[model samples]
Target: MSNLIPDPISNVFKSLAIAVSLLVSLVAAPPAQALEPIPVPIDIEALDITSSIDLHREAGNRLQVSTAPGADGIVRRIEVPSRDGTNTNWAVFSLANTSDEQIDRLIVAPNYKLVGSALFWPDLGSSRIAAITPSQGIAPERQKSLEADVFLVTLDPGSIVTFVAELTTPNLPEIRIWEPDVYEETINAYTLYRGIILGISGLLALFLTILFVVKGTVMFPATAALAWSVLAYLCIDFGFWGMVFKLEGGGSQLARACAEVMLAASLIIFLYAYLNLNRWNIHYSHLALTTLILILGLLGVAVWDPSIAAGIARLALAVIGILGFVTIAVLAFQHYDRAILLIPTWCLLIAWLIGAGMTVTGYIANDIVQPALGGGLVLIVLLIGFTVMQHAFAGGAIAQGLISDIERKALALTGAGDIIWDWDIDRDRIYTGNEVEDLLNLKRGSLEGPARDWLDVLHPQDRDRFRATLDAVIDQRRGKVMQTFRLRSEDGHFRWFRLRARPIIGSDGEVIRCVGTLLDVTEERTAEERLLHDAVHDNLTGLPNRELFVDRLRTSVVRSKAEETAKPTILVLNLDRFKQVNDSIGLSAGDSILLTVARRLGRLIGQQDTLGRLSGDQYGLVLLSEQEPDRIVALADSLRKAVRAPITFGDREIFLTCSVGIAFF
Candidate 1:
């Protein structure tokens, strides 16, 4: 039975081995097969009707009615229809020319033309017929006229030829009409428009800048209108809307020449307008006028003597244009901020870049293109003019408003505040208004000239900090500086003032002056000082109380630990039966004793030392001296002995022996 059954472990091992072998084979093997190449689908259906026909039409059928295709095969059959003859038709196209003289005498004409569309035939494709709108038949011819090719065949008088009019079939692909000669006659038209715009914009910008400098009456509205017009024209040109559609007489060259002449003239005029050359120099104005006249003369020459104008003259003129604009840009960049003048000039300068870009990537030109590419700067001048006008009108208003705002704020600040002061750092003057006297009770006329005028007036404790703040405010050029300081009064008292100010902006956006307000906060400050005093000092004696003493003790302990050479000591003492004596005499007598004790301690303590009334009949002293502990103990003993002197308060001999605590560092 066991032999018949399969070994489970061996079977499992065999399966595992097979899987491992398969994985190993996969790891060691090359890829199963090379990837198949994907084929790009060529959609010949998208080619233009003309290209398709040119590609697909029969080689023999490449002939059109136009003479451009030299003499070819015979037009086999001719036919036309008459409106009355056929069911409501016009003329018949199917007929034989019974009387056929030479084509010089035989003529056929169309009564009307369809205004809806344009038609073109292409001969290039497998089925080279590009059918646009299915089969659109033509109106029937009124009569028969046959013209035979002289080389192919000659028709004698009265000789017959059958002619058929068939517009029933179409064969070709679709066409994208956007792509044409990218830059052509339209460039001239657009250039002319742009030149006009540029000239106007430049003139306006110049005029406005002059007005801003001279602070004069200027024409801004006209400039703005010109700018808008230029922009509109540029948009129209760039959008390619019907730019070359006006080429009727003489062809595209005439239209282009017209546009170029207009735009170029606009540029010259704009330059004059912006610079106000008329006012600046009479000779320059006349010269500018002559240059313009010469440009006009050049246009006339182009129209009349194309041979001369098309020769080396154009190259010479282009060089002049480049040099003149470069010179103007260099000057404008240094002296004036005229984007119109700069941008238009730079546009002409980078023609090479634009040309290269357009060549590498073919672009479709539109109707708007004529006004843009056509050497017309009329639109550009107009645009600059309008911008200059806008800046003149609105910028003046803004600057004036800002100045008024600053003045109003300054006046308001002085009037509303209890103190007004000026820090003329350069002039070394600290001028305070009459209100400062009211706020600080300081000598009014004294602070007008020098820093030392008020230097001696400050509380000895606050003098350094007050001087530091003043110096910092000016040196760092802080904006809207805020300072809260105590100023010494004529009465030998200190008063608090909160000074705040904003810096004035100059035409160059720099701070030219500081306008500030000083509010008298002495009363509020006094209240705050009193609150702090109550929190840390005895209300009656004005000495540091128990809380302040403990805080000082902790600070001394931290300092003593840091210094090993000199350690801090705290002397704790209790009165020698002073409580019993106070009860025997009275609480008032004990109070008198305590007051005397507080006064003595405060006097004996140095500037850095502190003295405080810890509690009734208890006092503390802090001594910051290099003296030994015995000397400190002696000082404490002296303080205790000083308090023991009998107090003569309202003719009463109040004697009290007290213990004193001294902390030494």
Candidate 2:
């Protein structure tokens, strides 16, 4: 038997198929006997209707309700005559005998403002006996159900009667009847499901709105706007707004319509930013303009005629939505970063649009359409929110990197003891880092001086020159400048500093700002000065050597000739016993004697005179003269006496003499 299993499996499948067919036949078979209908209670006292002896009559078949005098959209009463030959306002329910028993407590529901009502009768001639009206007041959640607002009536197994309803204001003249338990169950179940959907959508909207607030992303706000419009539309259509807020009339419609316009505007804005629409080859400007115009038109309609505005807004948004879907599809194919996110979002939007359009156009019921719309809108809102946050994080990451780089550069500058500065040429403002005070050796707040006063802290002699240098960089078309100058610090001591700057040029080739570094060069300048002095001054006697002496003489001679003054005089003095003294003692002793003689001779000169060592054991002097040979003789005699008086060297008393020869030009 096991070896024949393959053939057995085929036989078993045939048997299972026959069993399934039998089950289907049994499930689909007609009932053998009719069941009795359950009789439910219809509480007549709940109707709360007061009847009149004669019904109020209006001339026309259709009634038009308007606001009363001195009231803002408030109408007290309305009388609607029957459209047919019947001379009464009647609500008729046609029932069939599906079961064997009567339907006792069948509820009839209508849409109306239920505050003040006239009466409900079984028939025109019958006395008002028993009717069922809403037990609860303004139930928004319940309004989402098929059995939200209703009146209960008793009917036979098979009967058709025209029920008369006298009213203050007439609503759309259509009604539905259902069994009490079925009505309650359906209402409760539908309310629960619809409430959940609405809640999810509302929460999604709130989440997206928060994202928009946090990230300032257009997508979040746009998605939220669309969600709000859909939510409001559902609320208005299902009478949820009236139930929740106890508000009625055109005001609710206006709010819903306004939400629609906002939805359109928000979508346009989001698409523009997300898709970079302006940069696209095809101009979206006209589309944007058209959207704006439509939104404006919707707004005008909402204010002037709110009843029709909601429909117009829905139609406009649907058209815009289709266009947006196409645009987003194109963008996605082009591989835009956010377009991938929008593709799924647009698909959900399509579902929402189809569901909403079907409901609005009366193709489907509110229960089916609302859940579909709510779910689709929730997904759309969440997708947009996620994309927005993703972009925000990416942008934040790049910004953080740039900020970190800037911070590192600043730290490096601080560590290197460099002062970074910026000078706004047009504004005449100077900005500097904290390192400025440290580099400039300035007191804590001294750096806050005005731009013009920046040069005030410079050394008085260098101030004009520094200003000239800086101006050359700014006004003289110099692009980059590097110069050294002395700046006076807070302690009143001048320190050398080097300023290096590069101009920030504007588009018109004008310097807009100058960014630079200021470095303390006091140590460098001091070292340079020492090296320069060592190069031109005598090392042993600390007197100007031949190089410096000749330079001064040349300068003086040129100046004297230019001024027509007296010619300068140059005198060379040779130490007579300098070599004999060196041979007698030592080189050290000889050097000491030469130093002593140089000092004695240096005191004979005036401020306008020059004294220098021309060479080993040879000295020179320069003086200004008015061509008095006698004056020259007297000066020469003074030098000879001074040099001849020099004596001591260590423990020895040495006498030194020099031969002086004077020359004049």
Candidate 3:
């Protein structure tokens, strides 16, 4: 029955069995926890002490101490040897107030500081405790002080006593005998040093803020953030805020945390903004925000539990700092063309980080973080100044390029005989970059008014059509259009122009403006007219040829047929022996004789008559008159006598004669 159960029941049974097995294993296991003290102490012997006060070398120098904590969990209570030669000894020293002034304080301190270490003296009162090695990191002012990393004891005049300290390390540190004048000088120097750093960084931040506001550029904002971060760092590191603002306890720690977070976040922002990472790698931007959040979280932990958070913060900062440097370096390398100016900045930042790493790992005893950070910050300010100069140069170059392009286009337009014009439909105005007097033979500003002003200049035959075409363009009924028409100028002469216009559409798909160009086609129109004239008229004598003469004769015949009192007459005249004149002289002489005969006949003919060149030397004349043969005979005689007149060719003279024939209808 069990084997025949469904698969679901068996699967549930197997899962439950596995869960039971895991629970059994966990219950059987021992709880894992730390067995050592909160801060594990290192024991030191007095025989290892290398240096001490001259008077106490024999008695107090042979002391042994343990860095482990006392009953209160604070590092104090130095234990002395019970027997004559036991495991440990204590350092006993005496001080005599020889001067008239009373000695108020004494400082017992190490010559150098170590991380995760502190020194305590119960004999000096509770508030007089000092860190031998500051776990919270050294401030810029404290790092430079001669007596800051020491324990202080208060005493009256002429008081002699012995002091004991838990040796935090095997190394013996110096004991500072504090004097009124020396302590005053040390405090003053520390303050002055810190004030200079703060002032310089503050000014730089202000300068960068001004630049950001003026330039309205992303680079300036990012760089300004960097400068402000430096100011924050100097404030936190030098304890200047503690003096001025009195931010104590959690407030000071929190302020320091915020400053550190700003420092890291600013570096990330500066790198991405300098490179314009939104155009390149958006993922890096997201990563930068994530890392910043992580840094903030770690800092929050420091406010609650500093011991655990300090280790984590250091490790996290080291990793993040290295990663940030590498990421920016890689991006800079990839975008070296645009990031060339940032090379000095990133290089100095990496070097500063290396110095900080050295300080963290105990290789460097002195503080390098201050100088490294200060130098890097100054470099960033200089880079911003240079970037501004480069931007101005680039702007100038772009403007010059635009000017050259306009000049080049202007030359091309002049060569193409195109004059540009702009029309503002909303204003009902037309503007043209052309000489009104040269193009339209008008006064200089005649066409500078409204659209109606230009329309008024159009020839009467084209004025209505021009208005219609222009309306079509403004209405966007046509994408672009070209039309040729005659325009009457100021001198009453008409000139042909081809106007081409295109409508410019707004975002709403309505035409807001029209840009047009005009081409003067007067010479072109004249050539076309001459071509039409040559096809129908004789080229040499400038008289209507056979085609035109026949058309006129046909019209006359039609008219005469319709009218009862009117008749049509035609006359043909041929120059007799005209070939002899050309053969004797030249074709030029023959042309001159023909011209003379045509001119004479032109004078004799009435305004209603038509005269044309029929052939090489023959001419024809038609008239609308009575169909009387005597009238035709008289007109033919007149034409014959007209052709027999004398003609002159240059200096040569010749007489021309013609045979005439007449017909009546």
- Top candidate on TM-score is 2
**lDDT tens digits, residue span 1-665, model 2:** 46556888889999999999999987885323211222222332122112211132442344322212211222223233443434333322122333446554443444421111111210101112122111112211222322134554555443322233433232322244455676578657767877876787678678767766665545456656756765675565445776777554455546656765676666677777666687786568677867777677778877886646655656677887898888888888889767777787778778777766665544664434545555566567667766666766666423322345676787677678777767888877777755667655777656554566777887778777777776887786556878887877667878887888898889888888888888878999999989999899998999999999999899889988899876889999998967888899999978887788788877877778888999999998888743588988898888888877748766777776789998887
**Backbone clashes in model 3, listed as residue pairs:** 60-92, 63-89, 64-89, 140-237
What TM-score would every model get versus the actual structure? 0.32, 0.41, 0.40
Estimate every model's Cα lDDT from 0 to 1: 0.47, 0.62, 0.61
Clashing residue pairs in candidate 2 are: 78-168
Error of 1 at 13 (Å): 99
State which candidate has the highest lDDT.
2
Q: Tens-digit lDDT track for model 3 on 1-665? A: 45576889889999999999999986985332211122101121111122442211233323433323322344432334323342122333333333345434435343323221221110110111222221111211222333234444443343333344324223343445554355567667767866776787788788778866665667668878978887886776667666678655456556655665566667667766666767777887787678767766766665665434445544554565567557656766776544666566556656766665565454664434444455555565556546644653565323322345676777678778787777887787788764645666676767766888876778888888888888877665457868998878777888898888888888877787888788888999999999999999999999999999999899888877787545668888988898899998888777877887888889987788899999999999887643567767887888887777667677877877788887767
Ranking by lDDT: 2, 3, 1
Candidate no. 1 TM-score: 0.32
Q: Estimate candidate 2's alpha-carbon lDDT, on a 0 to 1 scale.
A: 0.62
Cα lDDT tens digits, model 1, 1-665, are 35654689789989999999999987985334211111111221111122211221221222222111111322322222321232221111111213334321111121111111111111111211111110112221222211110111122333332222222123212222111122224335645655565555545545655544443333333343334334443333332222435322233233333333444454455556555556546886787788778766756766764333323233333544564566466657666655344556446434632432242233522323323342334433444445555555666433432345666776566567545666665566667767777655655676677666666666677667767766665556554667787777766677777878665555665445555667878899889978988999997778888899889867766776877534555654455777886887788767766666677767766776667677765666656653587888787787777767777766667666766555554
Worst 10 residues of 3 by lDDT: 119-128
